[model samples]
Target: MLGTLAAVPVGERPELLAEPVAKAVAGLPGILVAEIDPELADTAAFCEAYASPPEFSANCVVVSGKREGQVRFAACLVLATTRADVNGVVKRRLDVRKASFAPMDLAVELTGMEYGGITPLGLPADWPLLVAPEVAAAEAVVIGSGIRGSKLAVPGALLAGLPGAEVVENLAR
Candidate 1:
């Protein structure tokens, strides 16, 4: 389903992918990485310019909150068609008080991925990957390649099967 773009096999991913994402997905089957113009990296722009539908685009958001007086983080993935249930579902799932979007600086610093390109693949080891059910079911979804210069097309199963990934119902609203 990803034949629309100029993509390389996952094993041949370029350096544009963050070190962690590249390392994690190396040799993984059913993952394709496509280099894109940084100017069209945002979801809407990328979709329109690349002929990918919104339903097949996954947005990765970083959420943070405090649990037991210590900060906790999670990478929440939801289809572009919906929004992550951050205040309700995500906060409850993370078992934290007052969960909110992570500050851009912190997100970039911690994920080692550029803004607009944070992906669950290379998230902090301790951080959980909260995936929306739809995203986990799509045959193929476009996601960040850890940088604004490229994107990744991955099978839903591959994303849901990532270490610490949890596909939750109603995770998106």
Candidate 2:
């Protein structure tokens, strides 16, 4: 006889993983993927649902801006307790005319990830990955799996392994 299975909400389904995120993490070693019980597809929700308080405190918020007629996006990982100094550091480093939080629709379209599920992994190879130096110091960090309800815990080193990640000290103030 087949046993009855409990139904799970879309935001809490364990198997609802994103393909791109899986592909990006395929060959990485020593990484653990966890499914969150609460919906963590957005920054605020993610911070609230994060189990490790410190991790939540140092969350990354992805932002997109325009410069020289080109669209640029960056993953600004900062303390959830703090805000990324976008205007002072990110804009200056990217040499952009304007820097602003990318709209949810554009962020999803450009990254090919669901809103609130966007992560640095699987991002376009050309897009810059700017990480706060302090976050890099952690042994492992939890990041979105390109879908809600799932997160990937990866070694700090793996983040730098991405094609164009640049380590930036004081990325946020």
Candidate 3:
């Protein structure tokens, strides 16, 4: 069932879904939720097991930086084929003197989601959601559904339009 995109009441209210993912899917149109095995949570395993194309999978990374003794966070989303421009583009865009990936513990604590399942959908309102232009241009993208037990299939434009989301060029390379 990994690759089969099962039918799980992903209606206006995805009741069977987890809290963080359900909250997000309930609000967004044209989004589907698929329950998956936690053991196959990582992108590579999930994709291979589910027959998903790596091209359609997006990874959400938590980036952090400090300026004036303040730490800031942002969620950078790029396709599996590329990596986020963390030190260069991210640092400059965040306007932080320096930027680096957030610590695993901090990311988990702040997002209130599993370490590998932190999604842009329910991140802090203050944190920016930086989406690569290519990702926004895709028909749909597969992203963590707030937990390792599932993934959210959502339209790229919808993701780009999320409250804190911004389409940025050179986000990934």
Candidate 4:
């Protein structure tokens, strides 16, 4: 659960979300959005400043790899307390020889989100959204809102059900 920061139904704060993220969560249920200092968008800083627990915050990382001269991209969602198994599970899932966090510039450009606020919502339809089981089963979790100035809080089940999302066991460590 989030502390101190006031959270409102996401639908009521479209301005707090990036365009694509706004559209993606437009009619979703049980989603809350809160405004935060852009400077504290990073998970550790945001949690510390907002009095939120690190375990209840989810990090969305953009991963990419090349295979046979083609590039593939995916979004991996893991709890702030864990790290995604990018080179192991993710590389095998994407059928790539290696997987790594995508460059910040490319991630921002492709997701149409700020550098530190790329959430799993509104990723390109073709991009696989791999979610760790821990994140998908949490009662609630805080995640980016596609903008540095805000964050979204939602039930883990909601994230697991997002379009393109695939809950994967041991996706994180």
Tell me the TM-score of each prediction against the true structure.
0.95, 0.80, 0.92, 0.99
| Cα displacement (Å) at residue 11, model 3 | 3.4
- The lDDT of model 4 is 0.94
Kindly give the stretch of ten consecutive residues in candidate 3 with the minimal lDDT sum: 7-16
lDDT of 4 at 102: 95
Which pairs clash inside model 3? 3-50
**What pairs collide in candidate 4?**
none
| lDDT winner | 4
Measure candidate 3: CA RMSD: 2.1
Give the clash count for model 1: 0
Model 3 stretches with alpha carbons more than 4 Å out: 7-9, 12-18
> Which candidate's TM-score is highest?
4
Query: Would you list the C-alpha lDDT of every candidate in the order shown?
Result: 0.88, 0.65, 0.83, 0.94
Q: Please give the distance, in angstroms, between residue 69's alpha carbon in candidate 2 and its true position after superposition.
A: 2.1
Rank the candidate models, highest TM-score first.
4, 1, 3, 2
Per-residue error (Å), model 1, residue 21: 1.1
Q: Encode model 1's per-residue lDDT on 90-119: one tens digit a residue.
A: 999889978999999999999888999988
Q: What is the C-alpha RMSD of each candidate to the true structure, in Å?
A: 1.3, 6.5, 2.1, 0.6
Across residues 1-173, which tens digit of lDDT does each residue of candidate 3 receive?
Answer: 22566734367435434566566666467777787888888999989988988999999999999988899899999998899999999999888988999999999888878877777787888999999999899898888877788787878898899989999999999
Clashing pairs in 2: 41-116, 57-80
Candidate 1: misplaced stretches above 4 Å? 1-4
